[model samples]
Target: MCIENKYPHAETTRIENTLGQRPKMFEIDMLVPNGDAFEIKWRDATTDGDHITKEHTRLKVIANAGYHPIRVMFYYPQREQARRIQKTLETLYAGVGGHYYFGDSAWQYVRDYTEVDLLAVLNRIASEKTHGE
Candidate 1:
């Protein structure tokens, strides 16, 4: 794992917290030496998946290990799916002592306030699509 330039002095590490007695280890996405960790959930992370059962344990392992883990859930363009996942993710993240973040795109999650101009972004994307056409 590489040290993030912002956290240069902090070594990055990965932890394998097994999903169950079956010995399936779920790898943590990222962790910093200074006790900051991040675990990501991709598209359609509704509570119905097989791995969903083990998510709480995974988060507990990270937090119990002394890191302030954050759970970032990716967003979908589809409104219903996105809303469902966002609601579920927020509920889980709160239960496990981690921060919850979700966005229409990854940029929205990381950007500081006042920089999220969705209209401008959509317009630029539309213009690019026109070029391809």
Candidate 2:
């Protein structure tokens, strides 16, 4: 989902000075409803330094705000790179509850599966303040 915010009464001076009339700060490619966020890089995988850097920055901001943030790098139409990214995400979030999947299917299966819906699982976890069966 794309969220667009028009300039109304919120810091036109700063926006003009920093962005020089650019309308977008950043485009969030995909947001998983359970709170995991992702930015996709489909092609031109050779030039992903900027994308990865920005994704980590966003993740840090969200984490500092006390929310779980996950960065998913998608190399769509490139199966080899996608698999590599999948492995990386799995290893990175191995022991963390909020870090799994990051909206990707391959790494998602690395975690244990319950027959419950995501919300149900999340609610149970929240109530218990713990993960695992």
Candidate 3:
């Protein structure tokens, strides 16, 4: 089965296999083959306004899907809040079987898990800017 988010919020792919009546589908934020199922929370998505406990629910869904759901807190200029956010994400990830990252280190963790060449992408952007491309 093919899963696509196409939702304003985070996306999950509906992985499935035919069983009895229909296919068993799992909606995970991101399920990389033998890698990680990721749930990215930007800003104060966890405790902002009425969003308290929302992240927890999302992570739970991933876990119920039989995937290790990783929660990544994305906080940039608000580095001071990173410490608090990291604590929250860590606590949740600990309860689950996945992992988490915050602050400047967030991108690094995601890159490692997703196996994306972030440095190369950034270098290409820099080169283009330098060469006015």
Candidate 4:
């Protein structure tokens, strides 16, 4: 995958020694740049609902830590599921900075990594404040 330096190095955080937790660790996918933090969730139709919950908790914790939490949810796989997840994400991110990309198809979200240059859409998103339409 083409690693773009546009985003800062991601730090995955988890609650330590929390055994027997159904969700295990809440991996906080983040890019910290200029002292601000952005949270990313690359999800497909098959993505577990639990993952979304965990990510939201992680975002809340990040915000509690005094960092700007930007939640970016990339939903692909199916239009109907994408729309569902997009709406859910919108509600979760109300008043927060974030965006959701409902890809036309799964390939659209992975084209670049698959030698199809599909990342243009994601690149534009990474540069913009939000993703819609």
Candidate 5:
């Protein structure tokens, strides 16, 4: 809803999943026409190897659809396996000419792209809630 409000033209596009026996559609987080296809995650601590393959395929699909794939993960995992998976994902993103941002960089990217100080706004809301409570 924030994306729709901020970027009136931004859309959440669906891609059909042909790999599974049952047909399904994968939702791309947010896409701006002639711009970036964003895959956003609050945190991804997936240690599953399949996750990597799935992400790789998703990136390819975005690229094939004529959009630059960009990943924004606000939190980086602490576990060793999860960190390794994150690293692999970072490499995959770079391999396909996509950009990956994590931690502070992720927040900065959102602020830069949306021209809004999202973190500050969130902090203000949090402060208000704490004080009101």
Candidate 6:
């Protein structure tokens, strides 16, 4: 919502996925037209090892479409398995010349890219809820 509100032109893009046996389409999150592809995640706690491969394939598809792939994960996983997966994903992103932002960096990326202070907005919402405004 924030991205759409800030950049009304930003839209989800569908790309062909040839990694699977049968070609299908993959919907990318918040793809800015003629700009980088942004994949925003609130959290990734998946311990499944296959997740890394899936992400790699998705990144390749995004890049193949001539867009730089950028991943922004707001929350860092606490579990060991999940952490390993994140670490692996981070490495994969780097290997593919993609950008990965986790935790504070992720928030900063959103703020800088969108020119919006997400923390301040979130705080205001919290205050409104508390005061029943």
Model number with the top TM-score: 6
TM-score attained by model 5: 0.89
Better of 1 and 5 by lDDT: 5
lDDT of 1 by residue, 45-76 (tens): 35454445566677777777677877655554
Q: What is the C-alpha RMSD of each candidate to the true structure, in Å?
A: 5.3, 13.0, 8.1, 9.8, 2.1, 1.6
TM-score per model over all chains? 0.60, 0.34, 0.58, 0.47, 0.89, 0.90
lDDT of 5 by residue, 1-133 (tens): 4456668898988877555533366678998765688899989979699888888877776777677989999889889999999999999999889999999999998888887777888899999999994
Would you list the clashing residue pairs of candidate 4? Answer: 112-118
C-alpha lDDT score of every prediction, in listed order:
0.59, 0.39, 0.57, 0.50, 0.83, 0.84
lDDT of 2: 0.39
Error of 2 at 23 (Å): 11
In candidate 6, what are the lDDT values of residues 1-133, reduced to their tens digit? 6677778999988888966743388778988865778888899877696777788888887777788888999999999999999998898888778899999999898898888878789989999999999
Candidate 1 lDDT for residue 87: 67
**Residue 51: error of model 3 in Å?**
2.6
Winner of 1 and 2 under TM-score: 1
**What is candidate 4's lDDT per residue for 1-133, written digit by digit as tens?**
2223333354554443243355555454544544345444466453567756755665555555555654444544457765665567656655444433344443443343235554575677776846552
The backbone clash count of each candidate, in order, is: 0, 0, 1, 1, 0, 0
Model 3 C-alpha lDDT per residue in residues 13-124, reported as the tens digit of each score: 6654322222244445555654467655565433342232444555565666577776665563355554565566578777867677665677677565446655467789
Which parts of model 3 have CA positions greater than 4 angstroms off?
Answer: 1-11, 14-27, 41-49, 73-83
User: What is the TM-score ranking, best to worst?
Assistant: 6, 5, 1, 3, 4, 2
Give the CA lDDT, 0 to 100, for residue 103 in model 1.
Answer: 61
lDDT of 2 by residue, 1-27 (tens): 121122122211111112223333444
Q: Which structure among the candidates has the greatest lDDT?
A: 6
Candidate 1 vs candidate 3: the TM-score winner is 1
| Model 6 stretches astray by more than 4 angstroms | none
In model 3, pairs of residues that clash are: 3-14
Better of 5 and 6 by TM-score: 6
